[model samples]
Target chain A: MTVAIIHTGCANIFSVETALDRLGVPHILAEQPAEASGADRLILPGVGAARPAMEKLQSAGWDAALVAETRPLLGICLGMQLLFETSEEGGVECLGLLPGHVMAMAAFDGGRLPHMGWNRLHFEIADDPMLAGIDEGDHVYFVHGYAVPVTNHTVASSAHDMRFSAMVRRGSVMGCQFHPERSGKTGARILNNFLEFGA
Target chain B: MLAKRIIPCLDVRDGRVVKGVRFRNHEDVGDIVALAARYAGEGADELVFYDISASPDSRTVEPEWVKRVARAIDIPFCVAGGIRSTDDARTRLFAGADKISVNSPALADPDLINRLADEFGRQCIVVGIDSREIGGEWRVHSNTGDPGKTRTETRATLEWIEEAIERGAGEIVLNCMDQDGVREGYDIKQLTAARAVCRVPLIASGGAGAMAHFEEVFRQADVDGALAASVFHKQVIGIGELKAWLAQQSIEVRP
Candidate 1:
């Protein structure tokens, strides 16, 4: 399958690229609109504030191209956070692919900042291929402060401070709040499944 | 609920797994791949490969060795030490590690922690709290998970822990360097103290020497998991046997 990792300039391109390469698929990293439009799938990955992310996407015109892609597209971590309509991280507008807002993770004076490490993924829907060949109680990796509030579109959920969206999908667009590239074997399976259009 | 984890920490130097005491044991423990697989099938909840030396001499972990074990172990694994940059962390994850632990970096580049947590998510970040008892007070130590480095005093130490959480650190692995390998057991007081200060689940490291040491950690500190080395290396107890015992104690473990 033709997979394009949207290189709007801030995502962890190598990690995702390495994951796909390990899976034996040479992914086309979309640096320009023309390159992105040529793939069967588009992956949006990011690592910085939503403001810079959207700004770059606009300058590169990848955001418009992303909304146009009909093939299955996967967003990882910041990539997933970008799928929402807006994010409080710099108050930047997003792709509006999924209706929601991304804000800072909840914190009390004493609570830890930035949720990191392996946690359980609670499946809100059990019949998807994204987790195919993976176990029901598998531990997926996560690292984020802001998360989408569990909405009608959330396919899986996990609790940390509070229950939030773990994975969200609607038709061809899917996003994981965790980094599949860093999630070990379980992550690899998700990437492969994303490429194969389900596990 | 998911099962409790059993992790075996292997200190690496050059390209071999080495065991240490008080952070200085210096003995080869056979091939990392073989050792990892043995513990894995024996039901080790996870594996921790800590690069013991971070000096310029050992600038990076043997990536090929990392690749070997990433292919060897099927369960979750964490790579720590010398991981101060995105490229450093990226190399290990791409080579197959499940998570990356950083303490010095988390303290140094506050934004990197946030960026990583933001980019990767909390589950992939493991912040190490190398604590040492200073005049009966537990202090967070950086660049020394084994008590060799001096402690830095800063109000942000605690806030930094919180910042790590805010930026996306999901789990905190507290390595009680003071109690490490002392075997009397975990620095329950220190572990308890750190646990009380943070809402995130804690992984107790250092001073686990017996089967009961595991029990003491679980009973004393509300820890999610325990990491040990000597006992695992000497065959003093197997992960399976240890979990069986925990099961008898009514402690939940991954079967």
Candidate 2:
């Protein structure tokens, strides 16, 4: 039942930490890659640029360890972007845990660059454990410029300037472009589902 | 498409919530955490706690109070006021504020915006502008806490918005001093000037009297969010009822 939040040392992990705290879920802040193995699940949380984030991960040996994570793992926002092969943001390489590339959200269509605020979701699958009890049109808060392309792994999609993957999943690994922790009650449910469901 | 957001602002002074609200079933009516959580339950899209505390001592209480409120609610909340450096912004974020809103300090040192955006990402940095109509034009003014003399001097409003965006400001909050507390409505002319140059999301602040005012701002101005304090604080308008009303007006709002 132990959950570890991987601290990318890039963006503030306080919001994610606060969410877990409110849920009363026992968790640890895994600063180093080695610390991640002790937990039953790992949550990679981020919110800043990819290049410096990637460098931090590489320095902390998380780049190698993240690829080796056999436990159920979740990546949020910039954390989700880093799980991809490469990012158009600063032209940086990322952990190749998932397929497709990270491109500017505006590249899909010219809209607001950040694509921030709360938007509804259209779930690809009606019943995903990570999205358990969450409805098709439930609104979630988003705040990111770069996004992962809609691929086979995409479990849900949201439209801003154009349609983009809101949530992506590949086996034991899951990633959400929105801040589930900051999306109110529905977000709390998603996080709770993740804690209950195992690899 | 992103639904238009209705944000309730709380004024925190001397590390305590300034509004005294008596919600039924709650013993501590003045509890900031309780009040904030109620707003979140009432479908407030977001919350902003403007720190108006001017005391040099007891600085720790502000961040601690923010932590309590942020922990109590699941939605994003931003902290503004007296933040002059990257360290100050980082402290607030670490205390659980999702974003940092800066005003006068940013006007003084524009590079502080770039530094914060570089460290915390542009999404978390919000540049707050207090502007007033001076002479024949709308210009930016710093808050001086004086009603009669709110406008000390004028800076080019549109130019400042462009410069803030260039400095990596993720969002712009246009607080019209002319409309502030007047409740006439948002300064349409000033907002129009801001919309022309603002590339990021624009949040309209100051001068919201009733539901119609909110409706008018959304209809007239292409702003993303509308923020108000006393209306919500004094229970002049309930967040739930306001959102329902906005929804009925054909304005897309999160229910």
Candidate 3:
């Protein structure tokens, strides 16, 4: 199966690229969503600012192409953030595919912001293909400042500053707050799962 | 809740793994593939290869070696050394490096940082800074072009760091050359200065003696990750133990 890493010229694209490389899954570095349709699954990787990301997507004509597809789309950090209706990171509105809002991660008791490190996942669905082989309490690597709340669209949530959406999958579209590429073997399992699920 | 990170630093020369204190390793410690597998199995967050070849002539070896090493480790592997342009970064990324590290070129031409960020994206471009304290002030130092090329004094640490981030270096690697083999601890002051304006993750390198040093860097610097050579090489601390120690310190680590 082929998976396309939807590229909008954001940072961390190579990390995603490397993750796919390790998995040995053929993937296209799709500059636009049209190239994405060639693959069974699509990955939206987040690495840079939301404002510029949206601008690049618009400029690349990815918006229309993305909307036209019904295939599985997995979103990484900023990739997940952009799936929401809007994000506070940038005033720019997002894809509005998922019915949720992106807000800053709640303040930790006394810790600094930008919740960085590995944490466990509590799934909304008992058996999720995307979460295959990942034990219920297994820790997944995360590096994000803002978060997507546990709205109706949130499929999984984890406790941090406040309980927040850690994973979100909705009708062929998926997202993870963590960088699966950087998360090691467990993360690879997740990426592999995505690949197996027709990526 | 955020996830913890585990990293393994690999010193590669002529496609072989070597380890030593002060850039010296006794023998071929182990196969890069085997060690990479061990790190991946042990739940490493990422892997980094610092190419320390005597001459900069055979630069393509690292990326080629990365393709081979990439097969062994499932974790993200970053490549350092002789990476100065977007083309070089592209080659490495295509060859299987998760991130490409840039140093001299970033400082020599301020715009190269942003240009690279715009071209390859910011997070893929890691600006590796080798610094040393002179007169109680940290300064950026460039690796001599070759073994014969002399190390040149560059701009102040913080000043160049500001430009790096401004130009879109997604991450900063503070490689303290003086403390590289000293094994005392990282330069917390230098890390703090970079952290003040560093929007991306800060990886603290150089000067790690024991697990306490890891704790020191994590606690004092509040860095996203800590990287060291001698400690990991000499088996002072295993990846799991280091993560456990950080966990004991109440730092959320991957279990």
Indicate which candidate wins on DockQ: 2
**Segments of candidate 3 deviating more than 4 angstroms:** A1-71, A77-82, A85-95, A101-129, A132-137, A142-149, A158-164, A192-199, B1-6, B23-30, B54-62, B144-148, B152-154, B188-199
Could you give candidate 3's per-residue lDDT for residues B113-209 as a string of tens digits? Answer: 8877776666567888878788888888765324344364658888888788878777788887777767888778778777787767788888888
Q: Taking the tens digit of each residue's C-alpha lDDT, what string does model 2 give over A1-199?
A: 7789987875458788888988887788987977766689999888889998888889889998888878888899999899999999999999999989999887787676577799998888667777888988899999989887678988888888778889888888998899999999888888887787763
What is candidate 3's lDDT per residue for A1-199, written digit by digit as tens? 7878887676567667767877777878998666666688888987657888888888988777777768888899889888888988757799988988888664334444445556788877757788888878777766566787787767668877587888887878888887787676778888787776643
Q: List, residue by residue over A122-188, the lDDT tens digit for candidate 1.
A: 8887777776777766777665678888988888887766778888888889999977775667778
lDDT tens digits, residue span B71-182, model 2: 7888888888778888888788888888989877777788989999988889989998877767877777754332333344457878889999999999999888767766
Better of 2 and 3 by TM-score: 2
Clashes of each: 29, 0, 11
DockQ for every model comes to 0.16, 0.72, 0.34
Q: Give the CAPRI rating of model 1.
A: incorrect
User: Each model's C-alpha lDDT?
Assistant: 0.75, 0.82, 0.74
lDDT of 2 at A181: 93
* TM-score of structure candidate 2: 0.94
Candidate 1: segments with Cα more than 4 A from true spot: A8-15, A47-49, A107-113, A131-136, A182-189, B1-5, B32-47, B56-79, B82-129, B139-172, B199-201, B234-255
Best by TM-score: 2
Instruction: Evaluate residue A40 in candidate 2 and report its C-alpha lDDT on the 0 to 100 scale.
Output: 91
Interface RMSD of each: 5.3, 1.3, 4.3
**Regions of candidate 2 where Cα sits further than 4 Å from its true position:** B19-29, B54-61, B145-151
Clashing pairs in 2: none
